[model samples]
Target: MFHWLEKHPFFFAVGVFVTIAFAGLIEIVPNFAQASQPVIGTKPYTTLQLAGRHVYIKNSCNACHSQLIRPFKAETDRYGDYSLSGEYAFDRPFLWGSKRTGPDLHRVGNYRTTDWHENHMKDPVSVVPGSIMPGYPWLFENEADVETAYAEQLTVKNVFSVPYNTPLPMKDGSKVTVVLADTLSDAQASALEEAKLVAADMKDKSVQDAVAAGKIPEIVALIAYMNSLK
Candidate 1:
């Protein structure tokens, strides 16, 4: 086979391409499989969180913030740990922003509380002095698209097998289950319940009223999404 192939330059090039392609596949396939698995303790987003994510996107939050934290001491000190692919297994169209105009928010949920996010979103300068970020007063007034978020949940659950409603392994050897609703009404109810919990920590009366009226405002959803970053 080698003697005949060496005699033909075109055939030799084709063989070389095939050999390289096979080697590339061999190297990539295993890592892709492992990286796509959910990291231990990495939970899927709840219904409200998904809605909040939509709010984040609609507001173009990704343009200023990044979700990825590099593996460096400076980055680790400021942000949290280095990012892992498995940790984003459940994130559909991950918010791994291309630039860091503000800061990495991959673990913002870990440090910031609901009240803090509420205050910050209302007025970024209120919480962080000299902040260039503008306030999002509109988020408190606008409604979130819970329907789209629910659709996303269903798609990821069915297509990616995200382990929704199934026990997922944790770092402490415990298993937690993330339930994806079977119906739109159920998803809406669950999202409202979650929004209420988030609203409980906020001091804004308007936001409180919105949740009371069975509505999920953009601010509520945005906070929920931020809180899920951890």
Candidate 2:
């Protein structure tokens, strides 16, 4: 069978191509016809959460940590439910990624606390002695250029929901305008608003704790974002 397939390589290749094309087209037809395409759930981030996501991305955390869990029996047994498609509604270019150097963080939200998170960030070894994770002390030292970088995040939210037009007021009183929605459906708007409020409360408490401790890092925002997973 191998020798005959090699001798007729072009024909075999063409046949394989045709079969794949037919399968691909069939799979996409339903997707294209759906009226309500899945919208990823996203809400405006509090300053801290936005900063955290930036930290996560800038550090190339994706290089080691995937945000997805497989639905196979073994994966479900190990990581809980197979990741829900709806759960990732807010992720763009979804982080349901390819590598697994550490572990699936789909539910890391419930696993640790702020102080514990800070220790891990400051020196992974202090928390997990055998951890291969790199410490992110730069997060402790660097002052994020809050105005310019965070403005871009508002732009993205505007694109997703027209009612997201409310501008975030910076501490300096400058307003960041968003273009997404003037009025989201009641449910969508409520959910987004609730998420923002919760994130804000978390940021305030985290920052207060850091200040009280005096050993705190500047990027409590990033920590809040990490804790928001799932």
Candidate 3:
């Protein structure tokens, strides 16, 4: 066996290098190669979605849950549309992940009823019975507050390229509203507050609707991010 190994030393070295390179490369590429026939719809993450993603990162969820779905026959069948590159265009760090301690959460957005989510958030075992995952009671208990926090992050000033400081001219061109915080007036502050409230209300309604319908809230921006996973 030792003599055979020495004779094939070049092949062994090449194999080791190839394996390491492949492992590192997989972290960037979306698994579109394994996707079903036609590509699916996709979109970018909204500000709130981005914040939720940050939360996911802060919790180190990637350490245990893999976001990538392999292109194998069984994998494609189980995970829905295969992931694509354009799907994650808005992602800053990407979440292909490194392990699968839990099930693949590629299309998790589409799974489980809203109540199931609420229950799982309250106590995983209440829903999954034997789920090894820890319950996130805080997520449910502070639902409104957390949602408000998410909405606050989703404001256009934080996510889009609006000139918050440049003071956009109104349709009548009579007055100006600064885009940035350089010279925010009482009215501007009120408008911003209203916008935030609207966003929070939308998020709250989404969750309520999802619970009532026995489905998860699309959470507009969150839905945009999830559907983008292809």
Candidate 4:
């Protein structure tokens, strides 16, 4: 067979191509599957966080900021750590922006505080000197659509089988479960409970009042989403 293939260059080339392709698939497929699985600590977003994500998307935050962090000294130093593929497994559509007009936010939850986010969203220049980013004062007034967020949670839970209300393993050998309410009313209550926690850290009186009255502002949800990035 070897002597016959040497005499036939076309067949020899085809055989070589097939051999290489098969070997490549064998080497790549398993690694790709493993990397695509959710990272041990990765969990689905809660209702409030998902609502904040909607706000983030509505404001086109991804256009200015990327969630992906490259494995390099400068990037890892500025961002918390290099991004992993498994970390994005739960992302419906990944937010790995092509360009970064602002800083990456994959790990902003770690370094930035709720109070800092509150101040920055209301007045970007106040938090960062000479910042070109515009303030989102409206976020403090606009109510988050908890119903839509709840609908999304239901869809993902049913269609994609996103693990909700189930204990998920963490990197520290601990387990954490994210609750998904059974009804819209319950979800709103849960989100309000979370919003109160974020509102407690903010100095804005109006925002605090809104949460106290069982209302969730977009800024509260946005802060919840931002804090969950870690």
Every candidate's lDDT: 0.90, 0.59, 0.49, 0.94
Question: Model 1, range 115-177, lDDT digits (tens) per residue?
Answer: 998888889998899999999899989999999999999998888777889888888999988
Model 3, span 88-155: residue lDDT tens: 44355668788888777677767643344445555778867788988654432222223433344335
The segments of candidate 2 whose C-alpha lies over 4 angstroms from its true place after superposition are: 1-44, 162-218
Evaluated at residue 102, the lDDT of candidate 4 is: 96
Which 10 consecutive positions of candidate 1 have the poorest summed lDDT? 155-164
Q: Stretches of candidate 1 above 4 Å error? A: none
1 or 4: which has the higher TM-score?
1
Model 1 clash count equals 1
Give candidate 4 regions above 4 Å deviation: 1-28
Candidate 4 lands at a TM-score of 0.89
Count clashing pairs, candidate 3.
6
Write the residue-wise lDDT of candidate 2 on 51-149 in tens digits: 556667778888898888887898767666667665554455467769899877776765766667767877899989799998887776664333433
Q: Give the TM-score of candidate 3.
A: 0.49
Residue range 156-204, candidate 4, lDDT tens digits: 9999999999999998999999999998899999999999999999999
Scored by lDDT, the top model is 4
Alpha-carbon TM-score of each model against the true structure: 0.95, 0.60, 0.49, 0.89
